[model samples]
Target chain A: MITTSIESVPGRKIVEQYGIVQGSTVRAKNVGVDCVAGCQNTFGGELKGYSQLLEESRAEALDRMIQQAEQKGANAVINVRFGTSTITQGASEILAYGTAVLVQ
Target chain B: MENLIGLIFTVGLIVVAYFVGKTIENRHFEALKAREREFLDLPSLTTQHSYDEEGIQDCRLVYGNVVISGDYFKMVLAALLKFFGGRIVGYESLIDRARREAILRMQAEARQFGADAVINTRFEMSKLDAMTQNQGTGMFEILVYGTAIKVNHG
Candidate 1:
């Protein structure tokens, strides 16, 4: 399936509208990673552990959204957006939402 | 005696953090500049859609994100500046670095996917401070995403 952040795919025409589809996931890293991130924080640099965790969670959220679009019989998802929120010291929530539509 | 020891420890921590943080920030900025030069020709735009539909062969979503934290010295400096109600240069640079790094990563992903350009790019920046409550280590997460498109050469 085609996915884009723009309102419409570049060369495709929207033939059907399936409304909005969304997916969200709350994820956390292990204590070991969190400990390393805490040390990195004190030194003021990239928190590589946290960055990886967030990226994995975001991909999972996107996959879920794609599955939803597939269930809706849509060929593409457009105007995608992402939202993030920290839930606790080691966990975060990532949400992906977009409009699902059929294209030709 | 106890108060003197505590004061020395605090001062020493700030001194070390200041120098170390400066070095890291400088190195990061240099790296960003070098990588940006490498992707100078790959356009990353905020436009909602690809302008030339006929020239594009395929497209897919690509994204990059990063989590960065302020050093102890920056937190201390920002705290002091908060009292005076003026600009906080420390935090400003932190955000700037995170923003550029995120974009660079996105562009790198597009390159890996063999895409000519990225369109409809969007940025998301948020504070991860709640997770580090009372630690005074300001944390931020920056995410950038876009549609990477492969253009027809012929």
Candidate 2:
């Protein structure tokens, strides 16, 4: 499936609109990684553990959104946007939303 | 004697952190500049869409994410500056490096996909360690995403 953040695909025409499709995931870092990150903060630089964790979470959220688009019988998802918010002390939520459309 | 020892220790830690953090920051900025120049040909724009879609061959989504933390020395320096209500140069450079690195990564991805340009680029920044905003790590995450398009020349 084609997924882009613009209103229309470059070479495809939107034949039908399937409204909005969304996916979200709540993720928390494990205690072990969190502890390591806490220590790394002292030295200060890139937090590799946290970056990897967030990347995985984002991929999962995007996958879920793509699944939703497939279920809706849409061949493409456009105008995609991501949202993130801290839910608690250790957990955060990532959301992917976009308009599903049939392209030809 | 105990108070004097504690003062010495705190100062020692800050001094060590200052040297180490500055070295890392300088190295990172150099690397970012080099990679940015490498991807200079691939333009990324904030417009909603490309103006010339007729010559485009394919389009897809691309993104880059990074998380960076301020060193102990900068955290302390920023806290001190908070009292004077002035700019925190340390954290400013930290965020600047993060943003440039993120865009470079995005451009690299577009290059891998054989995309000529990226459109509708957006950035999102958030605090990763929200629980300890003041006392703990000054950490933040930067995410940049856009639609990459392959343009047909012939």
Candidate 3:
């Protein structure tokens, strides 16, 4: 599959337009990571615990997106972007989106 | 003497607990980093194309919702002991890690399709309300989508 951030793929051409293929995910934080993160203020440093939590979440979410594109038989995804919003004071969401297409 | 002994014991316990927790957290972080490295290391190339040339490809990728939940009661207690602070710091790092992982996965997928570049990528996040209310359990959905193009920069 050929994926890019731009609208068009260079060198090769997009033979078929596969409409709009997308992947989305909603991840919630566990209580343990939150509690450790809450205390990070006093200790000050890297919250390795929460860092790992987010990493896992992001991976899982992207995996779903890729699966969706694959289902459509897309050769690539392009124009990938990410957005994050705080659902609450202690919680937030990260989304990744892009275009799925087949190029030759 | 009794007061001194009690204080010493309490301090010792706290110290031991802190070390143990740190060790566990470090291990988890290491594992995550390894996974991230593997994803990013995948062979992939990036390219850009113009709309006039190929028209609107309109490609999208939707990932299954992955929910990861954990409780940091000890950390919360520690934060409470010191006062409600450092939440932002924790959040910043957490978000950063999450974004990186999402990007890596997208890149890997792009590579699989032989795409040199990805364009117009976007991300979305939401909270899992049904899961937890008080502890702030939320879901972060990363949707990395864009136009996969093969461009000739020559």
Candidate 4:
């Protein structure tokens, strides 16, 4: 599926707009990462574990957005956006939303 | 004796962190530079929505997201600089790394579609690990998305 942030897609014409489709997930830090991160904070540098967690969570959210678009019979999702929020001290939510459209 | 031992342990850990973190950062930067050079031909942009709106042939939405964690040393430096109330170069590098990396990733995705350029590119950056308000323990995530388009080469 082709998607773009611009209102219009290049080459193909947007035949129909399916409004907005979205997906979101809330993730908590793993215990192992928490323990290691707490200790690593004293030495400060890249925490690989947390980076991995964030990446996975983000991909999950994006996947859901695509799935919703698919269900809506959209060939593409445009103007995709990612949002984040700290729901609690231990968990954070990742949200991906976009416009679904059928392109021809 | 116990206090001395604790001091040694703390210092040793920070020193280890300094070297380890520096190595990782340097390596990531090196990779970023090399890839950026490879993408010199594909120009990504923020304006000029349709790639030749008149003769546009095909377009697709492509995106990339990256999350990078600040090293302990940078965090510690930021904490120290907080008292001086000045620019924190240490944290700046963290932001720069995430930003550049995210853009590079988006470019890579464009390349997959054989796109000559990406249009209307946008970025979203946030702290993924900002559990503690005043603490230096936080992770930065940068998400970049754009439309990859190929226009006829006239």
Overlapping backbone residue pairs in candidate 2 total: 0
- TM-scores of all predicted structures: 0.95, 0.95, 0.43, 0.83
- Please, what are the lDDT tens digits per residue for candidate 1 over residues A1-104? 89988888887789999999999999866788778877787779899988898899899999999999999999899989999887887567899999999999
- The candidate scoring highest on DockQ is 1
- Give the per-residue lDDT of model 1 (tens digit) for B1-154: 9999999999999999899999999999999899999998898998854467877888999999999999999988988999999899998898999999999999989999899999988889888777553357878789999999999886
Docking class of predicted structure 3:
incorrect
Predictions ranked by lDDT, top down? 1, 2, 4, 3
Per-residue lDDT of B1-154 in model 2, one digit per residue for the tens?
A: 9999999998998898899888888898888888888887899999965458888888899999888898889988988899999788998888999998888888888999999999999999988777333356478899999999888887
lDDT of 2 by residue, A1-104 (tens): 89999888877788999999998999987877777877778778888888888889988999999999999999999999999899988789989999999999
lDDT of 3 by residue, A1-104 (tens): 54445555544577776666555555566788656655542233344565456556666656676788889888776655555555655556656567777877
Give the number of the best model, judged by lDDT: 1
lDDT values for all models: 0.89, 0.87, 0.52, 0.77
What range of 10 consecutive residues in model 2 chain B has the weakest lDDT sum? Answer: B128-137
Worst 10 residues of 2 chain A by lDDT: A34-43
Is 3 or 4 the stronger prediction by lDDT? 4
Mark the regions of model 4 whose C-alpha exceeds 4 Å error after superposition.
Answer: A32-49, B48-50, B130-136
